[model samples]
Target: MPHSHYAPRQHASARADAPRQHQPARPDAPRQHTSARADAPRQHQPARPDAPRMSSTTSSIPFVSASMDLSQDPSSPYYVHPSDNPASALVSPVLNGENYNHWSIGMKRSLISKQKLALIDGSILMPPKTDPTYKAWERANNMVISWITRSVSPSIAQSIVWMDKTYEIWEELEERLSQGNLYRIAELHQCIFNFRQGELDISNYFTQLKILWDELDNFRPLPKCTCEAMPDTKKYFMEDRVIAFLRGLNDTYAGIRSQIMILEPLPSLRKVFSLVIQQERQTFGNETDMKVMAINGPWRGRGSSVNRGR
Candidate 1:
């Protein structure tokens, strides 16, 4: 109870209960934040593609863009490819006067592939000069004309000198050439009869015959019979062709022909052709072997004589 600065010291419990004074925060200490991230610099973010935009008018409508691809549209026949030009040779063999059948067929195929067959077949009629596609049709038609003119001999080209349209040229050619189907049939028959494999090989002979047969077929189209007899009719025709093919072969194939004919069911023309070809190969090989033996026989004889003397 002595006067110690005239003041008594408070207990430790009262000091602990007293409020503390304010202090500056340390750099590394966790501080109370006013906002979680309100003061931080904002980052630029790209809009999501699927997110709806906040527009009063457009918010209710979907954002869309569309484009049409028409480069490969098949229904558009007026489109001429960039590669199709005046100087392009479509067919291998150009049209000559006598080969109209072959030339016309080739031209038809080439035009059909190019989608320009309608121009020549009278399907795509000409349009008036005032029409929007008139110039387009004219350009395509002129291109076709150039191809046709260049695909024929000079003398033959003269025939189409006055023609202007594709159909005109095509019709003119067909008229001038297709009139002699009967005469052509007779000529083909004569040629087939005269054609023989005397000096020619089997393949060449068959190829020549096929050419004649195909040409004749164009003139004389096969019947499109769906009847029950159609099968028998085709078989009869096949047998006739086999006979014709065998008849053209050299006399060497006579035995093979006999063997083929003796069968109850005659083989197909191609089968008979293959069989004859095999026989031909065998005959050729045997001849080659015999020639080799003949050449070696004399040498062998000489060698034996020389050895005996020695």
Candidate 2:
């Protein structure tokens, strides 16, 4: 064992001749290699040929500018051009300071549809003796009569005579009244009495007079009497007393001139006259037709010829 321990040592060259060892890699080289590998896929791929591309200049345009352009175009749905606005013409310099008031179509139509006045009848201008104004008018007329009596002038005497005769006729008509014909006579009596009395109350008198005037306004001229005069028969008087009274008022009272003048035009009076005359003629015509029918009945029809008395 001593011999073996001393002989165990190998040659120094052989001991130094171990297998050739590889050198350790540098740290910077591996880090550089790792970075190159990571970048390789990005460098090999080609850019997409069909993808959409946006220009910075075009994208920078304002959205409001595009909207405004569309609004100005006439063909666009959102168009609102300056020339198309109606209010633009009304805003001129000349009209700016003016205060213009305008009415709507409906308001104008409503204004024109209203009634402004009532139609007045001429017969209503005369009132009867029972009216308060008629009494006042009578009192005033009595004063006038007293004055006339005191003076006793020829003209005044004539007026008194006329008034007396008128009163007589009116009294007869009022007492034996049958138709609307007497209304005018009654009104005339009241008016004449009022004229004679200057101090008559005019308030109720005017109102009553208006009614009578309106009534007489419907009168017309007398028709030619067709019937043969029967001896001792009373004649039917057809004169319009209301017209006569109006004429008398005009002649007697200068203060009432305006009222009297209003009747001068008398278009409605003329119309009433024509209508009444036509109606009267028609009535007479109907009566004559009835008489003819009665006369012809016996000849035309097979019946006992009994004379149908009219």
Candidate 3:
């Protein structure tokens, strides 16, 4: 029995020896295989009864909320079509209703009209009164008058001399004619007439003759008649008396030709003649007949009748 002794055995604790238990499956919780209907819809929601409902068929229409949101949100990278831009749409309404373009055009036209009217009214017009051209015209007229005056003086003076010389020669012939010195008278008359004719040729006698007649109309008794005339009361039978007077003269004499040539100094003799003739006509009756008589040869002499009747 002493050899059969045994070691004492210890009992095990219940908490240390117990195993971990698993959680029980939840019945009301979501499962990994549940259908999508179990989650809320992100893309669509049911409209509240009081909220405005958009028509499903009216998809083309834009929502006012979207437009306002786009305008308010600068960060949104969105824009309306060019046709729908507010500024562009307002342009036609403003122009047509307010006539903005028309008003601008009318204003410009009014300004231009005012400028044109001012021009036509001569408000800013300037005259050429102080210009060189005006002065030149005045000077030219004065020069013409001076030239005319100078030219006429010489012609008139020369004509007077010729007339005086002619008268003296005629007086000498009359003295001899009255004394019954027929040969001497005839010779003297012929010589003097020829001399007068030559003087006429040199002086443009017909022209000077007209000037003389014109001077005679206003004749106050001068110291002498430059061209002599028989007393008006004395009648001569010689129809060609003036021509007879001219025929007797010759050109060789110095006084005859010198007086004729003196007319050359008068450039405006023709003009002076016209003026004188006009003045003479006004003062007296037209002396055209006398002028014609002077130009044409004196009246033709009557022929002697033959005694063949016996």
Highest lDDT model number: 1
Cα displacement (angstroms), candidate 2, residue 78, comes to 68
Off by over 4 Å in 2: 1-197, 218-310
Error of 3 at 12 (Å): 99
Candidate 2 vs candidate 3: which has greater TM-score? Answer: 2
1-310, model 1: which lDDT tens digit per residue?
5556334455544565553322344322335452334334232133443244545347444323112222233444455777778987777688776778888888999888878898999998888998666767787888899899989888878888788899989998899877877888999989987878655556667888988888888887779989999999899888878888988888877899899989879999889989987987786755434443444567543333221110
Q: Please say which candidate is ahead in lDDT: 1 or 2.
A: 1
Weakest ten-residue segment in model 3 by summed lDDT: 86-95
CA lDDT of each prediction against the hidden true structure: 0.74, 0.36, 0.33
Clashes of 3: 17
The TM-score values for the models, in the order shown, are 0.66, 0.14, 0.13
Model 1 gets an lDDT of 0.74
Of 2 and 3, the candidate ranking higher by lDDT: 2
Q: For model 1, where is the 10-residue window of minimal lDDT? A: 301-310
Model 2 C-alpha lDDT per residue in residues 1-310, reported as the tens digit of each score = 8776655555444555543221234566777898898778666543332222334445556544543543344543223334332222212121111111111122223222311001011112223866534443343233323322333334333544555222332233233333444555576556644642122222222345555454444443344455666321222221233344334332224434344346543333344334433443453555434444444455554343333221
Candidate that would win on TM-score: 1
